[model samples]
Target: MEKSTHEPTADEKYEVSSSLEKGTNADNGDTRFIKSPEERKLVKKINWVFMPLVIMILFVQFIDKSTLTVSALFGIYEDTGITHDEFGWLGSLFYIGYLAIQLPNQYLLQRVPISKYLGVILMIWGVTLGCHALGRNFAELAGLRFLLGFWEGCTYPAIFLLISTLYRRSEQVIWFGTMFATNAAAICIGSIIAYGIGHMDGHLNIRAWKWAMIIFGIVTFFLGFPFYLFLADKPKSRWFRLTPEEEKIVDERTRDNAVVQNREIKRDHILEALKEPRLYCFFFCSLFLNLQNGAISTFASQIINRMGFSSLTSVILNIPYGASIVLFVAIATVLSHRFQEIGIIAIISCILPLLGAILLLVLPLGPVQLLGLYLSTTSPAYTLLQTYISSNVGGYTKKIFYTSANIVAFCLGNFVGPIMMVGHTAPRYTPAMIGFIVADFLTALMFLYVRWSQNKENNRRKHLEEKGLISPPPPNRELLDLTDKEDLSYRYRL
Candidate 1:
């Protein structure tokens, strides 16, 4: 039989409609609807199925991205004979593609099946990473890195969008924290794996760095199959096979979220998002934080090595760095959960890294400096930045545009970060240290603006509330896909 050619309608493609059916109350905006025993069970199943898949994808994909860092540990420089200048270019090229593609990605996000899109890109980048082992010169390596980065660009926004659509704001914080914490897991695991692979040098006449790339590539490619087969692409999913009653719960959750998932790319949403100061605040905050991240993550192994440890020993030392990431991210997550404050948590996250940069600058190189290095930067702020977007932004088009701009900041910071590793700053990397201090400080400042802006709006909305409860959403606002700006009743999350 010929394949069915029918395209699913908007109602069919977007499974969770805001307008409710039997037993599901449309007006229950702030209150959760999963009160029944069966409904609770369904919620658990949703969490169970989605969490591991998202986390594992994060773990492997991160390792794949950091393959260049890991390869540096195992003599990629000597093997390829690329100069420091070329090396910086190699690092920048990936993010260049990453930034280059996001404009198109903004549209494709609304047009495509994100799960399948992410899965396909995962496999493609896997192959690209594997091919990195074959690169003998700067040009080859640069091309492959660009391709890998170009494909990997889809990951964050797609995952961010997925989490926002799949769960309500209350549940989103956990997933966001867990998803980013997986970066630390990947670092630690990749470090351990690299430590072992480092020992395998000359086995089959293959260098350890090559082996690292090959192994990471194979694992990444295989991971795509499961994600494509199982991940829920939309709010209503074939994977969930949710019953009508269960579907109602999902719909209610989506209605409460107020960020409708549909194929339509409304021009006004994009225009509205562009005008919002908070949008620039989100992207620039990310750019500044990642400036430190891009520089530090690329050169972390080198920094440890310069502190008088062996290459393999530096690989071991990264475990502690990974530990620091987990600890800080955990604290940020818990505080956000406890206090429901985004601004303060973001500021706190930057302060650690600011201090870390200062320590790296002032103190003599040793364990203290290493401790500073670990504390100097972690991803709690970046994680919270993503959470801020998902929670606060409402229109589908605006959210994607906000997410895309954030990705651009991510790419730009990372692009310039590796360039800071120029040889003149050896022994101390003093310039990079100063760069971190300045960038992280800026990030903290921007988030302050974010919090103040949000607070002002949230406070204004309080007057609209009825007897201390949040005001009911304007009629059919959820179905209309109104932006937070358009919907006066939609409160800005802290």
Candidate 2:
């Protein structure tokens, strides 16, 4: 298939209509959607300006949320004299706040413009992060953590909406992969930042961890001020960059704002979203995948410390996971784009960590065990799986529903993940590892099932066409039109 460098043109109604059953198919072997050289140059410019700004915003959000996990290793538990069990409460408390306001967050993302709403949300979370310096006890820490969660919940749903609006289905996979990979960078950078500043424990008579938290928080808070100036709410809204030709193509490809418009959530919209089987499959599968991911993210520093590595060494060791994530995300994104087969890559990603989980559960604490833990952290398969879903699912209401459900499941999974680390399972952490292994296996099975169900649905639709019960023509040639219609060429591929 030839890739189009520009969107449909005004006089070229053929480009827009060709994907429908009633029109000629542009994607037939004899025809291709290749753009003119001038059009390709314009697309390159727009993508360059926008992709980095979006990725940077996501990176800061992850760094702020994840720093606490690393801080637990050298700062809080070391200085405040808290036990590991008490530390678990601190780690898991954020999720309580996360789940409390997911639906509200989605509403804000949908109703308010991204320029104002998301900018406000980012500033609030940054302030919450800075306030960690005020928490002197468990109760204070828990309260602050909840507030942080409340603000942080806005990031993912807002990003989903931005992505659904900004990019075509084929282009969103890499951007989402980059977004998730930033968390791995947080895992690495947070530890290094913590290790460097941790020695400031008695500086000005404040705890080192508290200072680390306050500094990063203040930095993130101030960073939001700039995003307000640079980030475009949608492709049509780009004020500083983009040629008129580039804007026209993007507008047409995205249906000229009709498909990407900000919408108000309604009761029936929620009900309509709840009826899809793919929604449940995505929720349950992602729930398990992130359960394991949360475990790795929240407790990795502690696990490294317990393996007899010094604080500096522990931080240094974390670099591998972050490095691996960068490589894997790039590889996965390219493979998904080239093959147009996200499901196969997703399945392979799930299996890697499952093996790693088993190794962590059964092996003795040593270099081999540490390697297992590091390898376990490299799964971006679920990241790709989710990108596929987010980029493909049509209609604003259903997209929001699936996005919110995914976040809710993520919070729920993280909540349960820490609880599994009961007092008896501490230190060695045999049960927590075993639990992750089970979650991985189940997630893998569900992904396979969804893939099978999608194939079956496609086959059934084809059979109906033969019997004249369904339309004879396929709309795959006109992918843009597929975004709005509920029938004919529209079908969720899970």
Candidate 3:
């Protein structure tokens, strides 16, 4: 894509220059602060206070969402009299609800306390999940699924906002990896739970699938209260007991990363974000990658069952699938941290899934097909994409808008994914696997485009700086809540 050739308007130039002058004055002292032992201690303290709650909530969320897929093997469809196509609609409609609330959810994230907001929604969704136990027909189940999606929509945006607010850009990838790795852990744990629950078909005079929904929902519902009480909204929140000097250090660290903790929605940031090429690149990449996710997440167990494994054995096999996700996510995160190249890591992750798709398409239905399915669990790419959004986007509103837009695209892809695999394509699902290959390749292409665009913009900034055509950015630019396009010195991380 062609780079934008328009220069900054005079008003924009003056605003940046003034902000730079003020920041220069404020940070006039030597700004080269090394990471001291105290900073490490602060980080450790922050991790202890923050990471656990977020990880737990995210794990529960994934498990709750995965219930439909797991329960399918144990007779959700058979008991409810839902046809195969109707089952696919259940997956798609959930995303419809998810997509419907994204814009409002983004606005809420900006104006409300994220932890409190998420907690409320989590409780609501938990109730919705539990209500799935009473779903006697397709309509009832679909309604519950839609409501579940609506409430759970708050989760990713809130978590992304929290990570961006709390961690530095360099630290975000690992944290994202850690948070998403819980999905894998959830799968492992959830499978074991499902295997055990599958045997309780007649207990309580309820179907085993109903038991799974009720039990998981109850657990999810109770956990929300703790998140409400304990999760810190930001560094300046009174919940964290930091000395004045420690607060100052925290402020400086955030400024160094060029991210401001701004709450008011900025129309300019939204407009600017709408015009950025990278935004669309990221959005489309997320869309395509998650298409594969929609199919695999909803049907992996069923696929295993079709391979001659009993339903119980299929549920148990998800442990290995979950392990692969954890392993790849960890390795990809470590690579991104060491190299500081999220784009490259993301591309590599995409390729793994594409290869998996090929195996699913071409290999005979057996161990190799299963191997391909497991390999295709490229959820690490989604984690990296979240890291990219949190790290590269500047201005709170723009960040919110960008992430929300990406989620909308994510919902669309998921909505379309399962529809592509109807009853006719059951065993091999050749066409669906082919679609996965196409989506994976396109996603990788988009990632490369995003990398190129960021590098291009970075080079343009460097060239302009060398020419002395623009004033150097102030150290406190982050405080201004300027969009990356508005901040001349802002460089995109690849």
Backbone clashes for every candidate come to 2, 1, 0
Of candidate 2, the 10-residue stretch with the lowest lDDT total is 24-33
Off by over 4 Å in 3: 1-34
Order the candidates by lDDT, highest first — what do you get? 3, 1, 2
Indicate which candidate wins on lDDT.
Answer: 3
Task: Output the lDDT of residue 45, model 2.
Answer: 65
Query: TM-scores for all candidates?
Result: 0.91, 0.87, 0.92
Q: For residues 194-308, write the lDDT of model 1, one tens digit per residue.
A: 9999999889999999999999999999999988888877877877878766776676677667788889989998898888898888888888888788877887888898888
Of candidates 3 and 1, the better by TM-score: 3
Q: What are the clashing pairs of model 2?
A: 19-478
Model 2 per-residue lDDT tens digits across residues 161-186: 77767766656777788787777776
Error of 3 at 195 (Å): 1.3
**lDDT of each prediction vs. the true structure?**
0.82, 0.69, 0.83
Evaluated at residue 96, the lDDT of candidate 2 is 79
Error of 1 at 419 (Å): 1.0
